[model samples]
Each structure stands twice: as C-alpha cells, then as structure tokens.
Target chain A: MVSDLSVLLTDRQGQPYSLTSERIKHLEYLCESTRRDIVDTLYKIGRGHAGPSLSMVELLISLYFEELRFDPSDPKWPDRDRFILSKGHGSLGYYAVLAQRGLIEKRELDTFESLGSRLQGHVDSNWLPWVELTTGSLGQGLSYAVGVAIAAKRQAKDLRAYCLLGDGECQEGNVWEAAMSAAKYRLDNLLAIVDWNNLQGGVTLEVMPSLEPFALKWQAFGWHTIEINGHDLQAVLQAYHQARQTKEKPTVIIARNIKGKGVSYMENKVEWHGGTVTKELHQIALEEINARLSELSQYADEKYGRNHG
Target chain B: MANWKKAPIREALGKTLVELGDRYPQVLVVNADLRNSVKSIYFMEKYPDRTIEVGIAEQNMIGVAAGLASLGFIPFAVTFARFASKRAADQISMSVDYCRNNVKIIGAYAGIFTGAQGVSQQMIDDTAAMRAMPNMTVIDTADVHEVRSALLFAAEFSGPVYIRIGRDEWPVVFDETYTFELGKGRWLREGSDVVLLNSGILLPYAVEAAELLESEGISAGVVNMPSIKPIDAALINDISRNVGAIVTLEAHNVQGGFGSAVAEVTAANYPVPIEMIGLRNEYSESAPNDALLEKHHLNPPWIAAAAKRALDRKNRLRC
Candidate 1:
C-alpha cells in the first residue's frame, strides 16, 4: 500500500528546507510503510532481525527522505553525503529505505537474505553500491565514519558522514576507541546516532547494568551529545539540524527508541531481536502498520487538503 | 661478510613509507600508538597532515583505515604484528578484508623479533591468521630491500594487504638492483639435492644454511618466499618435482606460518618430503634475538640440519 503523497524535497546542495506539519505526517506514513516492508521481508525470509530493524524505521526514513543529500540515480557520487549503518543487523529497515528512495528496485526487496541477493543478511557494500561499508560485527562503524569525515576535512569538502549505531553496540570497546579518535581529529563533519532501544540481544541492562551512564560516556569522549525521543519526527529532525551546526567536534544524538516501536507483541521483546516471523505474526504486524498509515493519510488530507494526500 | 651492511626492517619501512607518501598523494599512515617503533613516524614527520595517531587502539586504527580506504584514500595502518593480527583480527577481517578496502596493514615486530618484549609481543602465528582471511594479501618482508619493496608494492596495490616486518636489524638479502614482485619467490642459490625455502627475517639464515649444506656436500638450494598468500606455487611445484625435498624456515611458528603455506602448495600439487624449521607449536620466553632464534632452531646450523633431515627422508622414499 504505497501512497502518492509528495513531501518537500531538499536540494542536492544540502540547502535548508522547511518541514511543514503535512510533510511530517507524510514522513510518519513513510516510516509506517517501511515497517510493513520490514515485516513482510522478514516473514518471507523466515529469519531476520525484527526488533532492531523495526525500531530503526523512523530514523532511516528521516535520514534518507529528509536529511541526507544525494542523487538516488547516482548512488556513488563522490561529493554525496554518506550514511553508514553501524548496527548492520537492522539492514531490513535499511533495505526498505533504499527501495523507497528509488536507489534499488522495490521488487528486489523480496530477494533479501536469499542466495546471491545484494541485500545480504548483514550490510555489504560490495553487493550494493548504496552501502558505504560492509558491517555486521558491531562497534566498528564509528571508526570508519571517522575516517570518511577526516577525508572530507582533508579534501575541504562540505560533505558530512553519519553513522547509526545501536545502544547495545556501544558495549564494544572499539566504539569508544573510535569516539576518542573522532574527537582527537576534531571531526566536525562526523555525526552519529545511537538507537537507545534499551534492549540488546537479551535485556542489555540485565547483561551489563553499567551501561546506564551512556550519554555521559560519549560526552566524556568529547562528543557533542544530544538526547531525544527517536520516534518523534520533529525531535529527530531537530537533532540533525543541531548536529550540523556543531563545529570543531563530532556530535552524537542518543535517540531514545523502543526495540519495536509500532508492532504490539515485538515491542521491548529481546526474542524479536532475531527470529523467524510467522505468517500470523506478519499479518498482525502489517495490520498495525497499515492502520497507522491510514490515520496519517486522513490527518494529512484534513489538515493540508486532499492534494497533500 | 664484514662489509655487508645490516639495516633494521622498521627503518626501511619508515623510509619507504615516506617515498610512498611522495608517490601516492592520497596515502595516509595510521598508527596504534607505535609510530616510532613501527617506523610510521617517518611518514608522520614528512606528511604530518596525512598521519593519524590512534593511541594504543589497533581495533579503531584498522576501522578508521578501512573508512579512509572507502573514501578513496590509501591508508597504511601500522602496529605490532602481535596486536594487529591477534587483538584487532576481527576488525581487520570485517573492516578491511571483507570490505576489500585499500588498507595496507604494516605489522611491525612480526614473529620473534620482539625479543625483550617476550612471547606475548611475538607474533609467531600472525601469518596463519592473516593468510586465513579471504581477500587478505599476506606478505612477510625478508630483508631491508624487500621491506622497502613490499611497502612500495602495497601502496600501489589496491586491496587489503598485511605486510609483516621484523623489529631488529637483518642482513640485506636483495641488493639495490633487485626488483620485487608479488606472489613470486626469488631463488638465492640453486642446487639439486634439497631446497631451503624461507620467508621474513629468516631468509638470510636460509642462505647461510645453504652455504653450510654446500660445504657438507649437500648441494642445497635457497628460495625466499615473501608472499605467503598467492604464494609462488609454480616455484614450489618446480622445487618439489626437481629438488625432490624442501626445508622451510621462518622466525615464526611452524603451524600456520611460511612452512605450512609451502607444505599446502606442495601437498596439493607435488607431494614431496618437507621439514619445517621454526617455533614448534609453542611460545617463546623473553631472551635476546640470537638466543630465541637458537632456542627455536631457526638459526642457520639448525636449518641446515633440518634440510639434511629432509634430504634423508627423500632418499629413504626413493629407496
């Protein structure tokens, strides 16, 4: 159930664009559609990371549709802004966003995790040109992002590098090593967003109770830290804008997210972190997403006229 | 013998990196707090802007190097072989090798070269670990000239490469006129009875062993196999068929080092009796370089004895 609703498009030059209430509704609708796609894709594969992928839908939609600057037709453009999915197990959401952006054929989404499919179980750049780096094992993405940002600084390019990490992935020592180096290089061109879903593999807090002081740890690493409700479209958008304004240091936005935002049964459930989605569960999840999509469309039509729909 | 000048591979690496800095404008050197020890300091001195010092963090250094490579910058990530191959192996596998990033991993103090630092710092199994990774090109520098050439080659080559270098001084195996090529072994001395195949800092010892064998009427051949992966299979096949026996020496463990690489090639192509001379599936203690080499039976006399043993095995099979 794709919608023909058009939102304001930002220019390739990364010029400022106004986000109206109608556009926010459209973004939310898009996020809902992405959730449906994630469920359907995982249900077909019979095995995929459901919780992490579902939680990352809004963040991915915001970046691809609203924040990132690039021509979908030419994904390998040198001057294009880069996005690295550090928590690559959430690639179902990433693939859905890529399909929605028209970067990949929408039909190809069905081939995900299948033999020889470009959309591998984990993110692999070799299989897909849109992916900047191959990542599956956690905590390495920030370092790669730092290198890209350093390159942007050296070449005096105005491009910025963004990485989306998971809260659980932060337990990796390499993430901090990357954080220290990102600050040491004064990588103002770099921005990172951590999906603080609070549940990692098996209840993260139970596994490592010490992860509580997460935001302070990033601040101590010399990053410009911002905390926000990740699902709130407006707050997530504002965090992106604020990060761009920050200078002479890297910025990290700790987006407080639910493990599974939209679906009822999967929310905050670690078992859904990685599992095979059955047909009944898939239908239920799709119905939940579809219901939200319809509500968003009705709100957009009533508030901003039928043309907005 | 007295006139032959010895140069530390680390110094040669630094000098070659500076030369590479001049040649490839996009070349970036990444260090994991071992700049001076790994010889990355030379590149840091010349191209300060191009050098990234990630203090004592090999995992992050490799990830950052992979990131730089993704952006079309050729990054040479330098650290001790022990740390780079062991501590940061997963990062190297995922970030550099799997991604096929053009990151040159210069693993300094490879094998038993970290003498005073003891077995913990020694990387006897790094060759095995690095070679095991798909899309990883493993190179062990034989001498000062080879280390220079290996750096130059790795700088120009576009892929993930692990260049292993020793910490202490080594006798020059190749002169200025010698040219280096990837995956091609060089023949130092040719004989028909037995072939002395070696790599890394042990190449000179192999040559000395060959000389000792010659005096003992053993007519041994010496070949230096620098490229562990994409190894000189043709030379190995030729030696296996014609020479009939082989003795492989390295300043590494025999399990997954140069010897195992040579044995794999010979076992698959031409089955020949082979004797491996190196650390025998065990760790070394803190000692001087000479004592460590002697203890591990990686010295010339021991290597010569191993060659004689292989020759005897070949003769027995013939009988």
Candidate 2:
C-alpha cells in the first residue's frame, strides 16, 4: 500500500483527475451505507444518531481511502497514521468505514448502540481499533490529536495525526486552546477537518454563530487553512494530498457539507440529529440508499462500457 | 530528621522519573510552570529531552500528557493539586482515564501545605475525584519515603495512577527500605483502645496521637491508609474488631477522603461510630500549615480531642 492512499485515486482513464471514479464510487457507498447502517442499527436499537454521523460520511470515506496509512490486519501497528474523531457523535460514519475497510468485522455494524457490542454510540479507543482517543465529550479530541502530533514530531517519526471536528463543537474554548498548542509546536504533520454541516442539536450554525471567520481564525492561530466541498470526494483527496506536502504549520480543512447528504428527506434536517428511525422510516432510508447505490453502480458500468468497448 | 534531610513528595517523584528515564527512554515528564515548586526542575535540569513544560496551561498539559501516553510513553503529568483536579479534570477523565492511558499524575501541593497560597491553591478532595474514576489508581503517600516508593510502583503498575503529594518538606516516618504497594494499606502502629486511621501529612500526628492515647491508658492503632480508593478492607475490619473505636483523619474534607473510603467498608462490614477528623466542608484562608490544621481540627490537639470523644462513645457502648 502507498504511504498516502490519495495516490490510489486515479481518474476514470487511470490518469488521476483529482480523484478516480472508483474512489468516487467508494466515497458514495461510504456515505450511503453509513446512513443505511445507522438507520438500521438505530431501528434495532430503537434510538440512533442520524444527523452528525451522516454529515461526516464523505470526510470519513476520503480519510479511509485517501489519507490514512494503516494495515487492517494489524490495527495496533505502531507506525500507522493516527486518526482522532474529535466530533465523536459522527461515530456511525467511522464505524461503517472501519467495517468496509475490513479493520473491523462487518457484523460489528449490527452491534452498534447494542448493549454488549464493542461498537458503541460513542467511540471507545480501548474497545475499538483505529480509534486513538475515547471521545464523546466535545472539545477534547483536538487537544488529544495535538498531543499525538507533538509526540510524532518529538520522536522524529513521519506518522501523521488527523482530527475530525464538528462545526457546532467549535463553540468550546478548549478547541482553540488545542489549536494554539498545535500551532505553537509547529505540528505540520497534523490535519484537522471540520464537518461544517451548520447544525448542532436542535439549532443551526446561523442560530448560533460559534466560529465565524473560522478559516481566518485558524490562519491567525498559525495553521495553513483550506476550504473545500466536504461531499466532493475529488476535492477532499486533492486537499489532503496538498496538506501532506506542506510543512511547519498544521492544516485545517474546513469542509462545508450537508448534515444528511445521501437521503433526500433527511438532508439538512436538524430533527434527524439523533432522532431514531422507526421501522417505517428505516424502510424509506434503506430504499433511498439502495437507489443511490444502484445509480453509482450503473454510472460505473456505463463509463467502463464506453471506454472498453 | 534534619531540616535539609526532610524531602517534599514532589522531589521524590521528580527524582524517581530520572532514575526510570535512565532505564526506559519512554518515561516522560509534563510539568506546568511550577516545575521549581513541584520539584520537577530536577528532572528538567538532568534530562531536558525527557521533561516538557506546558507553561501555565493545565488543560493543555493534561492533553499533551495523554497524547504522549498514547504514543507508548509513560508520562508523569506534574502540576499543583488544585489546577490538576479542577482546571483539567475533563481531559484527565476523557483522554487519560477513559482510554486507560499509562499516565502517572503526580499532584503536588495537596492539602493545606499550600501554606500562604490559601484555599485557592490547596487541593483538599482531589483523591475523591480521582478515585471516582474506574480505571484510575489514587495514591496519597504519607511522606517523602512513601512518595518515592509509590512513584516507582506506579511505573510498573498499568493504567492511570494519581498520587497526591504535600508541598511542605515532611519528616520521614518510614525508612527508605519500606516497601510501598499500590492498594495495600501500611500498618504503622498497633493499639487496642481506638484505631487512628490517617494518611498524608496527618500520619505523623496520628502516631503522636497514638502515643498520647497510650499514656492515657487508651491504645490507639495507627494505620497509614494511603491507598484510599482500594481501601484495605481486611485491615479496616481487623482494626474495627480489635480497637474499640475508629477515628479517621486527613488534611482533607471528611466527606470524601480517607474517612469516606473507610466509612464505606466499615458501614457494610463493621458498623462503628467513626469520627471523621479533617476539614469540615470548608476552605482555609492563607495561614501556616500547623495553624491551618489546628483551625480544621486536624492538628495533634484536635485529633486528641476527637480520639477522646471516640473513647467516651466506646465506654458508653460497653456500659
């Protein structure tokens, strides 16, 4: 495997147009299946978090396929790239991607929100592989990631540390404290991706402008800032690649994405933040996701036929 | 003991890390701006590469310690007990304890030893908060000897360990040869009239109290209950049966310090009129260490008074 997975996202013609169609298909599946799994699991659980998890599906996909360097067989690989999900409410997206990458058993998806399952509603590092820090309490993950990044630099190791943040969670003062430390240490190997889905709980970002001028704020705090379409897999991959090339300052990729991207009824809806999908809603979500899966598969088939034929 | 010979617990902790750093390169120290006060300056001066000062940011210091621990480093986060407990408890709980990270948190300036820093800098109930966490091992060493032993023990012990240390240079009650275990309580003295269970700087006074009690025809057992969370139930049970009464003391709030931990064991297994002698749910203003203890009814005279009260209660029960 390439040290940087972004190298794998070649174009449809195998020329690497920012991102390949194969990788794009993977991103879409990650987003769809995450929503599907969360809905089904929640349906079984009788309670599930839908909004925040759906919001970060694309980021998780781009991370798993385009950035992080790790072995699924040996999850405890010391030299592996570390990923810290600071906005841990989006854990469903992480669980789906981990399962898809074979880091965890696919059946583990069913265990989510269940009593005995290692897959919990909140990410637990001890119980789950690839989770570097245990987080559900907001504002803590970034600081931990900064710690990891600083350690990597001290040891002269090339290991990169990535932290995913929620837009609403930025209201916490501790995030800025972590930002200052990361910048002070000049941890260029660290990358913080904020899922700017605009809503937190029952309120939208407009309802509470916690971090306006967010990009400039990071830049002021001594970070190289980049803004991109979070749902655009190609942009995410390209930005991640650029982030790796940069040095001396940490990178903050401000990704603007919808809370619910794949499911039409759920898109941008605040009610779906942690609302349970009833048996009836589960059917609708499942059907909608299946439709997207078929559409992407058909697109892949058409592109293959045109080129090969 | 000579004045210069009396060592602060923080000195022992810092000194232990240097010895450990020689053996294990991964043993790191994270200190706040109080390195000199916390005695971590010794480690910083000796092993500059191993020690890091996170400035005045307590929360950041904890987060950085957790991060270092995650990368297979044994980080001893050194800071004042007040800031370590209140200012950065969330990071300690989430990044450290919740993840079961191998970080030894050495809290300096615990109890009224803060002296003139007042109640703001003193940590009266830090052990209680740390004990509340499932995976955290809370240790309150009675003196410099116990501190040195506990710091070494924590290195071998897995998971998180929080050791509360006093700021003042305390007299060495135990010798360097004394073996310090993590959860086991040390039997300091044996008595039959009443059991004086105490820890931290209060042990010396408890020993004195036992001596005074002996002169008054009351044998007082002095048990140094350092490991508060894992209360030595068997030891406490033995004290309850052999001694007529039990008086728990500390330089802490009686609600959740050594008294509370002993009370939990005694309540279920052995019920007795346990007199909790410590700070009575109040903060102390800037004053001398002895004066602070005297005001909180934790000094030798106050401990003697509480012991007498317990003895009187014991005699009434016998009648």
Candidate 3:
C-alpha cells in the first residue's frame, strides 16, 4: 500500500504540473471524503472550529495528495517536505487529511479530543510524529517554518516548508516578524498560505479593520504574494507551482474562501466558527458531503476510467 | 577587603557559546536583534553560518528555536530576560515547553542589572514566570564561571531550558575548577547560625553579607542556587533543619523568585523562619547598577540586616 502511494506521489521531473488528470480527480474525491470526516469527527467530539476547518479542506488536499512528499509508513523521512499548521485550531481539516493520507489510522479520528487521545484540541507534536510543532497560541507557526526552511537551505537539502495560517491570525505581530526575516534571508523554499475567509471570532472587519490590502502587506515585507480562490483546486495547484518556481524570496498565498464552504446552513455563518453541531445538522452536512464525494468519484470514473489511467 | 576579578556576564556567555559551537556542530544561536547587547555578536562572528538573526522579534526567535530543536539542533535563543519572559512567554510555553523541544532560551540582562535601561528592560519576574512553566528548567547564573558552565550544561542537556544572565560586570565567585550541575545548589561558605540563600549576580553581596555577619559574631552560611525550577530541595531542607533561620537574596522580586521558591520548600519540608530580601513590590527606576541595588535594599548591609532580623525572629519563636 505504501509503495503504491510512493509511486503515485513521486514527481519524476519535480514538477506538480506533470501530474495526470486522473490524479487530480482522485485528489478532489479525497478532499470531499475528508470534509465528511471532519464534520463527522467534530459532531462526535461535541466541540470544534468547524468553519475554519471546512474552509481549509481543498488547500490541505492540494498539499497532502498532490504537493507534499512523504511515506505514510515513515513520517520522519528525511528530505520530505514539511507543513506547519500555524492556525492550528483548524486541526479537524489537518487530521482528516492525515487520516486520508494513511499517516494516521482513519478510526483514530473518532478519538479526537477524547481522553488520552493524540488528537488534542490543538496540534501537539509530542502526541504525534506528523505534527511538526505544538501550536494554537496563534502566530508562531510561520516563524517555525522559517527556521525549518533555513535549516534545509543550510544543509542543501531538497526540501521545502509550508505553513497554513488563518486570516485572523495575521493580526499577530509575530507573523510580520517572521515574514520580514524569511524575506531578509531570501528563504525561497518557504511558503505561507492564509485562509482569507475574512471572518475571525466575529467578522474580521468588526474585530480589527486594518487587514485590508493584506497581499500588499506581504509584498511590502518582500514576499512573492499570490491571491487565489482557496476553494478552487486548479488555482491552488497553480499557485503552489508558481511558489516553487519563484526564487530568492518567500511566497505567501492569500486564499480567499468562505467560512463554512460546503455546508448550506453553515456557509458564511459566524456561529459555526466554533460551535457544536446538532444531530440533525450533522446528518444534513454528511449527506451534502457524501453527495459531493459521489459526484467527484463518478466524474473521475467517467472521465479517466476506474483505474484513473 | 580584596577586590575580585570582574567581567561582563554577556562576554562569558558569548565565549562559552562559541566554544560550544566548535565542540558541537549542531549548536546554533538565535538572536532577537540584541546581538550587541546580548553579546551573541561574538558567536555570530565566529560561526556566521550557524547564527540566526530573528530581528526584534522575541516570540519568533523562541518559535524558531523550537523548530530547530525539533530537527535535533541545539538552538540557543538570546534576548532580554524582560522580553523573553513576558513578551514571548506564550511561545515558550506552547511551542517549546509543551512540545518538549530541546531549545536553550538564554535571557540576558535579567534582574536589576539592566539598571539604566529602567524597569521595562529589567526582568524581576522572569524567574517566577519561567519556573511556573512545565518542562522548563530555569537557571540563574551567578558569575562569569557559572555563566560559562551553565551554557555548557544547557548545550548538553535535552529538553527546554531557560537560562538567565545579567549584563553588568560581576565579581568572579567561582574558580576555573568550578563545575556546574543542574538542579543542585552550590555551597560557597559554611556557618551555623543563619543561611544566606542567593543566586545570580547578587552572590557576591551574599558572600560579603556572610563575612559581615561573621565580624558581628554571627555565623552565616552562603549557598548559590543556579537552578530555580527544580530547586535543590534537599539542600534547602538541610539548611533549614541545621541553621533554623534563613535569609534569601536575589536581584528579582521577592514574590515568585529565589526567595519564594526557598520559602515554599521550607514551608512544606522544614518550617523555619526565612527572611526574603529583594524588590518588595516596586519597579526600579533608571539608575546606575549600584544605585539600583542600594535603592532596592539589595546591598550587603541590607542582606546582613535581613539575616539578623531572621535570627531575631528565630530567637523570638523560642520565647
């Protein structure tokens, strides 16, 4: 099973654009299934940040299924690309992707936030090997990614570091500090993705109105900035490829997306940012995600055949 | 009184870091834009490729250190104790301590040594704040020798460590033969009537106070406690049991510092009368180093007076 994954994930030419359409369709299906898992896990746990997690599904799917290099059996594989979830409250999406990638057992998703569970409320590296750092007290993950990138460059390792942050977490002063240093060091191997759903605890506008011209802020910090619709798989993939091609500077993708992207009642709803899902709502969410997954799988079968050739 | 050889604590720290950098290839230095002040510039000069400058971001410095640690690198992050403890406390707690990263956090200009820099620069609450953190080994070095030994110890020891060093020149208390052991207090002088518990740049004052107590026909024992978190409870208990009275001195606030740590140990193990001589509850203004010490009642005479008061209280308990 691991060998099959390695064969599929190995980029012979080191270009993600060389991936087949079948692989992209398979990744799209995996993303839908991951969304279902996230909703189900949060509903079972009785508490979680559903809105933020839902918003980051496609971005994580792109990284885990298409961009990142790793052996699910050997998570500590040296030279493998690294990812740090700076906005760690969105761990539901992260854990779902990890499970889907076989880095963690799928059944473990049921134990999230439970007693003695590795899946804590926040990302804890001590509890899991795949988690690179303990985060949740926002704005620290990007700096950590910068450190990893620096180490990779010093060692001349063929590796890259990616960090995912929330749009709300940009308010933290440490983020800009890391941004400045990464650019100053010309860490071209580092990438930062901001989930620009634009709503924080309340609306980001209501909480703090200063984040406008966000991409320009990254540009001002000397980063190569890319703006894309986060929910669009093709745009996310293209942005990542562009980031890889850029040299002598760090890159940040301001992925504009909706808070609760796939669910009908939860979409764009502030209440779902960190609220418990009722049994009825959970059922509705699962039905919607399952429908999407079925549509994606059928499309892949019809377009690329059952073997995804 | 003979004058002792003195040197700035930062120079000793820089020298030791360079030595460690040579000995351990994985040893790295992370500075938060205070390279000149923290003396990490020396390390940067020696190993240009090994030094990481995070600019004025203490929080980012700590997080980066943790990241390096996760990759099995020994990253010593340097910044003012004031900022390292207060400004980046959350990162230290969550990113480093919680994750059990082998990151050495070197907090320079701890206590009242940042004298003219005023209360904002001074770190009176660092020991307390770092001690309260789980999986954090807190060490406050006394002299240049101890500073060198402490940095060496931090380089070898795994897990999170917060080492506090002062900026001003301090009297050399230990010789070249001095060895540093984590979680063990060093006994400098021996007496029976009272115990002078001290740490950091204030050790010279405690030694002076013990001598003063001797001239006054009082027997005072002096012990230097470098490790503040896993404090030498056995030594503190023995001193409390044998001496029956104690006087705790530090350049930090009396609350949640060396004094508070000793008091807690004695209160739980051996309930002996202890007098804590430190910043009672006020911030130090921008004054000279000596003036700051004098204003905070941290001079030798004040330490001797506090020892006498503890002895008097011990005598009163008999009545």
TM-score: which candidate is best? 1
Cα lDDT tens digits, model 2, B80-158, are 9988876888888998888888888888888887757887888887877888888888888788788888888888887
Off by over 4 Å in 3: A1-20, A204-207, A299-309
Which stretches in model 1 have alpha-carbon errors above 4 Å? A1-14, A298-309, B1-3
Per-candidate DockQ versus the true complex? 0.80, 0.64, 0.70
**lDDT digits (tens) for residues B1-319 of candidate 3:** 4377898788888888899999999999999888888888889999999999888888889888887776678999988898877789998998888878899998898988774977788888889899999899999888989899989998889889999999887798898878889889978889899999987778899999999999999999999999888899999999988889999988888999989999999999989889998889778888888887788899899999999999999889868
Q: Write the per-residue lDDT of candidate 2 for residues A1-309, one digit (tens) a residue.
A: 112234443422234443346646656765566567766766776766677877788788677755677776788898888899988878777887787656787777877867877787888887777788888889888887887887887888879999999998889878888888888788888999999998889777788855888899999999999999998877887778778867889999999989877777778988878877767777888898888877766433323211212
lDDT of 1 by residue, B1-319 (tens): 1234688778888888999999999999988887888778888989999998899999999999988887789999888898888799999988889888899998888888674888777888899999999899999888888888888888888899998999887788788766678899988888999999888888878888888888889899988888888899999999999989999887788998889999999889999999999889999888988888788888888988899889999999999
Looking at the true structure's interface, with contacts defined as alpha carbon pairs within 8 Å between chains A and B, what fraction does model 3 recover? 0.75
| Worst window of 10 by summed lDDT in candidate 1 chain A | A300-309
Better of 1 and 3 by TM-score: 1
Residue pairs with backbone atoms closer than 3 Å in model 1 (clashes): none
- Native-vs-model 2 lDDT? 0.79
The 10 consecutive residues of candidate 2 chain B with the worst lDDT sum are B1-10
Chain A vs. true chain A, TM-score per model, equals: 0.91, 0.88, 0.91
User: Which sequence of candidate numbers ranks them by TM-score, best first?
Assistant: 1, 3, 2
